[model samples]
Every structure is written in structure tokens, then in C-alpha cells.
Target chain A: MNDTNSVVSIKDVKKAFGKNVVLDGINLEVSRGQVVVICGRSGSGKSTLLRCIDQLESIDSGEIRAAGHLMGFKEFNTKLVPLKDAAIAKQQRDIGMVFQNFNLFPHVSVLENIMLAPMKILKRKKSEVENEALALLERVGLPDKKNAYPRQLSGGQQQRIAIARALAMKPKLMLFDEPTSALDPEMISEVLDVMIDLSKAGMTMIVVTHEMGFARAAADRVILMHDAKIVEDAAPRDFFEKPRSEHTRLFLSKILQH
Target chain B: MSWSWPYFFDYMNNGLMLRGVWVTIWLSIISMTIGLGLGIFAALMKMYGNPAVRFISEFYIWLFRGTPILIQLVIIYTGLPQLGIRFNVIESCILGLALNEGAYLAEIIRSGIMSVDKGQEDASRAVGMNWRERMWLVILPQATRTIIPPLGNQFNGMLKTTSLCSVISMQELMRSAQMIAQIEFRVLEAYCIAALWYLLLVSIWGLIQTRIEAHYEKPFGSQEAVSNSEK
Candidate 1:
């Protein structure tokens, strides 16, 4: 279904790395302000789907549309031609992504890291971008750590600053690729709390995470992927209590065991 | 023939030795500038260019790095003249030193670029940075920290390597020493003065390299924050 209001629409998208099939005929949709949580076994394409949506990983076949724009390509005479890197980058202006590693530039400070994209890519005015960056650092609860470098800050703080960096672009949709996977156990909740605040305030997010508490608290729908296909998609309450697919049931048992 | 401090001071204070110092400094500076230009292009070609371009760049690095620079200097200066493709003594020296320096710098640069976490490139793309923007603004900025110390070593090495140009009779520091030695017959004193000059120049560069490394590391908050990459 090509819904007019959908922020992201993936149609039978398939991706492979050489001979290994990564995403096999994945079909999904996310509406504006929807929080979709995806969890699965490591090779089940949970993170690949997020990368595909971001166009960092090219799909072998099928199409992904983000914010009504066809991703990574231009449509000419019913033929799909891959767009130039600049064109693809322009199309990605509305998408913000936070990687698992935080990836804060070590050469710049935290405030500069948050200010860089809006000032460079979007060409926003420097003073305005600086104000917004400061406000975002405050929002993420690290206003005083503006001058600190990524190596100086703890993992949780770095991830929070990464989120602030992404939001400085004022993107329409945000993608989180297991944002907390690299953090210490005690630090996970700090990053999750920022994400939960974003969810409560109506941000469109697609998160690949194993945090079931986050899923139950902030997710609109929970999806389970098995062998590169999304095998189960249901409301959190329904999926947690009455999972339909045996794969998801087994998956939840394994995760919840801890 | 006896050791004399007055004779040594006289040799060191001459205008001829001053000109020799100028020639050595200018030769090294120009060669380094050319080497840096060639090195950046060669590194990018090898890492990101198509197969054909990559092969060409690889062969260029291989040809230069595989041979002694003195032999290359002789070939360019003496051998090419016989083939009717003549370069002046100065041009020949620059061509030889720059090509050899570029090859080593290329490998140093490529490794520095490779050492960056792949996630940095992904993060740049996620923020809508194009390939060139990411390379210049993001990747190179981070790669430079890893690239600098080795680059400093390369620069100091390049300074000393200019001595080889004397074999081509380009009249740099060593050539001047030879000329002064043969004429004045103060062989020991003239060569000793040249040795002292070389040592002083290298020591000055070492101090400057340390300052540059400290400046680049300032953003990281501590020297340990940006760990030293292998030389």
C-alpha cells in the first residue's frame, strides 16, 4: 500500500553482499511520528534495513522511499537510475541517523560536532546554528560539556551528543542503529531516556534495539525478523503477550531470560 | 695542517657557505611542496580511483620506492640528457627527490586514511555530506592526527635527503663543502663546518615538528587522547 501519509515506504527491497543475502524482500512502512522497534538475531537484517533506509547500503533490487522521495535513484521514463552522490546526499537532507559507535569527530569539540552538519551541509547561519546547538546540548543534559572532545566524555554522553548532532539538522525522521549496543550496562538508560523523551514528543524513529523495556515503553509497534524477513509485526502489548510466530516467541524467551 | 679554531671560524663565516645554506633550504622546501602535492593525489587514486587509475598510481609508487634515489638522480640528470630529454641540474634534483618522497608519503597518507573508523564516513553521509565534503571536512581532519608524526619524520628525512643532490653537482651544502675543501685544502675543517650546519638545521625542524604535533592535539584535550600512531 502506497499510503500518502507514510514517511518511509520500503517495497520488496532486497540486498545482498556478494553471495550472502542480507535483506530478502523486506516490505515495511512507517508513518510520521511512528516509533517502530525492530529486534532479531544478528544476521537477520535488523541493522541492514536501517542502513538501507539511510541509503548508506545500496539495495540490490526493489525500492525505498523516504519522505516521498525515491531513495538513491532518479526516475526517468519508468527506469530507475542511480543518482549521483551529491543528488543522493541532497535527498538525505531530511533524514538523521545516530550510529552505534557515536562517531563524534575527535578533531572537534562536542559543540562543534553538533554544529557541523547544520552549518556545513544545510548552510544554516552560524549564529543561529550555534544557539540551536547549545540548546540541544542542554536538552540532552550536557550543556556544560560543550568543549569536551569525544575521547574525554563517557560513552553515554557521547551518544547523547550524537543525538543532539543529528537533531541539529531538524530532520523529519531519525534512525537509530542499536545506539546503546556499545555502552556500559549502567549507561544504557541515559541514552534510552533521551530517546524516550523524543518518542513522547512525537518524533518519527526506527530503532534496531534489543532493549525490550524500551520497546514496551516507547514503541508503537514491535517487529521480529527471521532469516532476513520480517516475520512478525504487532502492537507491543499483543506481541509481548501473544506472539504469533514461533520464531518471535523463541526470540522473546531468549531476550527476556536475562 | 694543524687544528686551528680561527681557520674554522673563517670558513664558517664566508658568503659562499651562506649561499650553500640558502640552496639547501630552498631545494628542500620546493621538493617537499611538490612531494606533498603528488602524494595526496597518488594516495586518493590508489584508495578510491578505478582499477586502471589505481594500477597507474601503484606503479608510480612502486617504481620510485624500489630504487635508490641517487641512481634515480643520476638517471634523470645524466642519462636523460643522452636521450635528448634534458633537465637542468636543479630540475633534475627536484624531480628525483620529489618522486621518491611522494611514494613514501603516499603509503603514509593511505594508512592514515585507512586507520579512521569506517563509522566516521557513515556518520558524515548520514548528515548529508557528499564524498568530497566528507574527505576534506571530516576524513582528512581526523586522518591528519594519525598522519602528522610520520609526516614530521618524513620532512626531517627529506631535509637530509637533499644532500644527495651534491652528486649531481647542483651545488647545495655538500657540494659547497667539497668545492671549499679542494680549493682551501682545509678538508677536515670545511667538511666539519658542513656537518655542524646540517645538525643545526635538523634540530630546528625537530622543535617545529613538536610544536605542530602539539597544536593538532589541542582539540583532543590531552596528548594521550590522540594516541601516537607508529612511526
Candidate 2:
């Protein structure tokens, strides 16, 4: 299923934590401009799959490619060897990730948090980076909060700023690991609205969220994972209306009742 | 033989005592500065280095911290000279004190770095930071919040620890007091002046430490009700 147009391709990716296998034979392909939302139970390895794409969690075995490079390994004389930290870091730069907890640097202002990576990693001009950072804050609808600290912001505001921070690097692919999972009920839609706008702008994204509304509204393909495997992959309408897998039907019944 | 008020008052304001105070202050500042650098380097090595590098850091900490600073000072200043490694009194004092201080500070820094939330590292890594950038930009800045209070206490101890160097005839506060007591035979009076001066230095440092702690605690910005306003 991998193609030149695909931004992310995973082949038989597997991962484990000690004796607990997390991702088992997980294969997925996300094309450019595709918005794929992954839904699964808490221990279902949905988050691990997303994390493995950026090498935040190393896979046990498999080939996963994103942004035109292998995730954590390089082909050295036809043998797969793990890339060095600097090399892995360069690969990571092309991919952006937003965490469930937001993880905004509490010591810096919102503007600085957004500006840090582009200036330090990319070595862009400070003035130019500052202007771009300001524009990102504006895009996230928080221009006046440029100088505010992360602790001073609400949970929703911080997550938005986290997204803006990731966007500052201008990543080719963005991964959201339950981005709105930690937000207050009223704040969820605000963060999701920004995400919906991002998806509409043709950014390739893989979001691991239980917010089915997001799946219906923004996702081009909705994936259901269970027992460390992808059990369902279909358009939102078919996945919701005409479920195929026994796991999908069971997951939908459990999810939609909430 | 008596507690001479004249000798006590004279020693407190005398040129020799004043010079001793100056030496103690500069020695503490320079030694503490170098100790902090050594500490940070050692802590990073212990936490992240390969086995060989980590072993070096661990052994340095173990050797220095295992012995008394007084013994360490004597070895560096006196013992090393017989072995063809002769340093002047000031250099020996700094080298000995800094080496001892670094051992203690290394553990303090390691705990401080550990205290920072793990999410900070994850965020930094996701943003494409290498290990160096992650440390200097993200981890250490936050760790400074936890490191300052303990670091202040260490500095307070270091001010008095410099007195140990007096055994080597380095002529800091304690040595100056001993010299005056030897001639004037006002042992109690001269030593009391040195004690009071040490007290004064630590008290000044305490005030400065409070300001530093306050600065780090609110490093982001002032309280302006940004969160309150949002809700």
C-alpha cells in the first residue's frame, strides 16, 4: 500500500515493554494531506504506534518511514543499523508531535516556546523566527499571550500553543497523541477546532484520539486498533455505519454509548 | 591573659584582618565557580556517558567525597609537592576546595535534573533538539529552580571551609586571627573577631540567595492574572 505520495509508511512494526507486547505487526500508510484518526482502548498500542513513527518509542522490529527517511535506523551497506542521536534528531525535525499534556516549557514565554526549535535547530535569523513565531501565536488565536508563561495559560490554551510550537518547525507530518484528552470538556472543541483547521489546510496528520466527533469531522480515514494490531481501517462513514471487523463492532458499541 | 576589649576592637578593623576577609571572599567565589562547572560536567557524565566515562565521573566523586576536605587540602598542598606536583598555596587551596566541592555538587545537580518533569524532555526531543540542546536549553534551566537552595547552603559551608586552608599557612580569616593572638596573647578576642566576620559574610549571602530563589521561581514573568482572565 506504500506509494510515492505517502508521507508515512509502516511495515510490520512491532514493539514491547518488557513482557508486554504493545504494537504487533502494525502496518499503516498515511498519504500526503490525509487526516487519519486512530481510536483504541487505553492499552491498545494506538499511542505507541504514533510514538514509534517519531522514534520517541523505538520499535522492536520493522521498517517505518516518514518524511522520506527511516524512523530510527539507516541502511548501512545494505544492513539496517540504528542511526546515531544526531542523525535521528535530524529525522525527527521533519516530524512534529503534540503530546496529551501539552508539555509547554514553563520557564519561557509562549513566543519563546514556539521560537526555540526553529532558531536553535534550524538556526534561522532571530528577527525572522520571531515574526514567524508571532504569526503562529496569531494563527492559534493567542497573539496577546506572546509573553505569558505556560503556567499562566489554561489547559486548552497551552495545548494550542504546543501545536503552534510544533508548527514553527514546519514539519512535513504532524502526530497528535490524544491532544484533547487532557483538556476540560469545554476546552476540547477549541483545540479540536484548531486541529480541524490544520487538517483542512492539507497537512498530513495522524491523530490518536477517542473523540469520534473529530474522526467524523476531520479524519479522511478512521483506524481502530485492538490487542496491539490494526483491526479496522475505513472512511469515517463506513467505519461508523457499516462496521466490518468483530473488534470494530465491539469497539464502536463500547465507544458510541459514551 | 584577660579578655582585652582594646585588642578585640583593633583586630576587627585592622589591615591584616581586612586582607584575610578579602582573601576568603575571593577564594570562595572563584573556587565555588569552578566547582559548579565541574559539578555540572560530572553529573552529565554520570547520567548519560558511556560506561568508561561514567566510571571516571563516579570515581572522581567517590574519591573526593570519601575524604575530609581538610585531608584533601593537606594532600594537594603538602603531599603532592614531594611527588613533584608543587602548586602555590592559593592554587592548592582552590584546587583542593573545588575538587571537594564538585563531588558534593554533582549529586545535588543530578537530583535537580531528575526533579524536572519528564515531559519537558519529550517536548524538547520532539522539537528536534540533540542531547546538548535538550540539556542546556530545557533540562538545566528548569533544574536550576531545585538546585539553588541546596547550592546556597553549600556556599555557606564553603565560606567556613576556607578556614581549613589556614593550616597550610594560606593566611585567610582563621590564619590572620591566629597570627594576632600569637603576639597580643589575646586568643579569645582575636578568634572572636574572625567568627563575627564569618557570621557577617554568611548573613549577606543569605539575603542574596533569597533574591536568587525568588528570581528563578518566577523566571517566566510577573503575575498578571493571565489564567484568571482567560476563565
Candidate 3:
């Protein structure tokens, strides 16, 4: 999994809650500007793996490196110890994440949501951050929604604002955890369009989604997870046309039926 | 059996009674403001501090809330002087009221902060905000929506509770009423005037509370419409 150009490296990552295993011995490498889509059944570890990469969920054993630094641990006396909150926060600045729910701050206008992290955490100049935030809003095709509250917008529009908010940090990598899973069926395409544009602009991304169309259209590699392990990993063409694993075949059948 | 309308009117217009009402208003305003600050501090300590810090806050809240405010006032104004510790009348009244008010408000504030969605926390953390930034900028603003209604109710109670300080000879509204009653033998009229003042003060606060609540509600949009659209 070691690669000089890799933006993210996961080796033998294992995570569990109580008695239930969520991610088991996962190994992956995401190179710079690579668009990776991981698809699986509901209980598969795809989402958890994405969360682990962002240090939102801690791994029980093994290592995860992102943006040229350890994810959640700092080397102390040649032994790995968990970093403090401040250090962890510094690491998180480089890796942006979007949840299934938009999770925008309901109390603020959309523009403030985009401006807050850069201004407060990074201590950037207000005028500079405000300009970048407006640009990001324009990038997400919501330039007109600067003053709108999150609750006032439709779910799809809110998700776009969430994407703009994440982009305001100018992160090295982005992780999307079911970005469109909560939207109405008709609203899914608008959010996906923004993601596809992001992928085209050469931002490193790892997406967890059930949208096979998106996987085939924009992904460099498609991965199938089953029973807490990655069962299949292949280029999009081979993954859809000629999957190697029996689990991939059955999973594909179930999802592709409709 | 003998209630005099003329005496009631005279007491209501009395300069002493008017000053007493002013004192009561000042006491409520100052104590409630200080109590709110203490409540926020204590609640944060109980929620996020280490075990020792948590125990200190827990004990403060328990001691203040469990005891009667009147006894606490008496102890501060009268009893403490026997041990070479003394506070004047005004200071003791305010200290007792604020400590008691803080204990109750701590619980109210804690519950309000807890009611905020866990997702809000996750989002704030994802943005690389430190604990202080997250609490102050993100969590507290949202928690305030839930905190306001109960906070208003607490202030309303505080307006009336200042009467207890009269026992400590603080010369607030109730004390003035009692003095007038004793001197003029117009107990009914004097007390009635005080009651009317209390009713008037509480009514004004109720209106202001409604306005503040409405202002906070604006960012979240109407509750009914949000729920319907979300569904």
C-alpha cells in the first residue's frame, strides 16, 4: 500500500464497536487526483472505512496515513500514541469530509457556514475568507444562496452548501459518505453533478455511495465490500463488465436489478 | 372586613413604595444577569471538566439548590458576622439570590445544551474547530434556542422571589409594604399595592420574553413548516 504519490494509505486497518466488527484488515491506497468509489450492502464497511480515514472513527490496529501525516497518532518515543485534540485538529484541516446529512449549521446563513472554519480555525483575514467563500458558493452553483438559512433550502440545495463549506478549507483530499443517500430521488443528480465536477478538477476523493452510474461514469476504481472486507477492487469497466468475486456478482445483481 | 380604597391608592402612590419597586427591579436584573453567567460556567464545568472540577460544580449546585434561599440570605447577612465574616444588606441579598438562581439555571442550561442534535457536534469537529470554538461558536448558539424559554421562566420567578430578601431587611418591595402596613395599620392596602406592582413587572417581562424568543426562532424558520418540509 506504500506509494510515494499516494494521498491516503491504509494498512491492515481494523475497527469494531463492542461485539460487532465494522472494518476488518482493510488495505487501500488512494493516489493523488484519483476518484475512488466504494459500494457495498448496508452492513458492509465502506462508510466506516471512509470515516476511519478522516479519524472520525478510530482503528483498533494498524496504520492510516493521509496527506503525508499519520491520521490520529503522533510518534512519541518511537511508540504510537493518540495525538491531542489540537494536533488532531491540525491534521483534520487537510482532509475534508461530508456526511450523509448536510449537517450545515442551522443557526447561520449559508455564507457564514462556508466562512467559519477558515476564519476561526486558520485565523485568516475576514475579507480573504469571505472572497474565497463566495467563490466556493459560485463553484457549487449556489452563489445566490449566500444569505439563506440551511433549513430554508431544499435537501439537495443544502447538500451543495455543505460541499461548498467543505471546499472553503482548500483540503488535499475529500471524503463523501453517502452524499446523496438522503435526498429525494429527483434531487440526487444536482448533488452528483457538483461531485463529478469536483472529480474532473483533479481533487483526490473517496466516495461511498450506491450510485453505480456515478461509479462507472467518474470513478477511476470501484471497490465492493462484503462482510467487513473489500471483496473486489477493479477499474470501473472490469468491475461492471467482468467482476471477479462471487460476492461482487451477487451484490451487483441485487443493486442492478432496478 | 374593612378595606379602604383611599388607603390602597395612597400606598400605591407613596414615594417610599415607589422606591421599593425600583429596588426590586434592580435586584432582579443584577442577580439574574450574574446567575446566568454562573449557570453557564457551572454547567460547562459539570459537563466537560475533570472529575475533581465536576465534583466542585456538582456540590455547588446541590448545596445552593437544596437549601431555602431565605435561610441562605439570613446566614449571609446575620450568621456569618458571628464568625468574623460579614456582608451588608444589599450584598447578601444579591449573593443569596444569584447562588440559588445559578443552581436551578445550571440544570436548565445543561438540558438545553444536551437537546442540540449530536450531528451539530460532528459537523463542528469535522471543520477542525477546537473544543472552545465548537462550544462557543457552534454549540452554544444553537443551544440558546432551547435555553431561552426556560430562561425567561426563571427570570419571571426571580422577579417575585426578591420579596424573600425583605426578611433580611433589604428594603425591597415587600419590606416597604410591611413597613407601611405596620405603621398605618393598613395591612390589606399595603400588601395589595405590592401585589399589583409584582403583577405589572411580571407582565412586562412576559412580553419581552416573547419578543426575544421570536428573534431566535427566525434563523431556524417556523417549527411547523420545518417539520412538514423535512417529512
Q: Candidate 3 residues A134-175, lDDT tens each? A: 999899999988977798888999999999988888889999
Q: Candidate 2 residues A127-233, lDDT tens each? A: 99999999998899999999788888889999999999999999999999999989999999999999999999999999999999999999999999999999999
* DockQ agreement of candidate 2 with the native complex: 0.60
Q: Cα deviation of B76 in candidate 1 (Å)?
A: 3.2
Best prediction by lDDT: 2
Off by over 4 Å in 1: B79-86, B219-231
- Evaluated at residue B11, the lDDT of candidate 1 is 85
**Candidate 2 per-residue lDDT over residues B1-231, each given as its tens digit:** 668788888998988999999999999999999999999999999999999999999999999999999899999999998999999999999999999999999999999999999999889999999889999999999999999999999999999999999999898999999998898688899899999999999999999999998778774445564444434
Candidate 1, B8-45: lDDT as tens digits = 89889777877888899899989988998899889999
DockQ of each: 0.54, 0.60, 0.52
Off by over 4 Å in 2: B219-231
Q: Name model 3 segments beyond 4 Å from true.
A: A1-4, B223-231
Clashes of each: 0, 0, 0
Classify candidate 2 by CAPRI docking class: medium
Fraction of reference contacts reproduced per prediction?
0.73, 0.61, 0.56
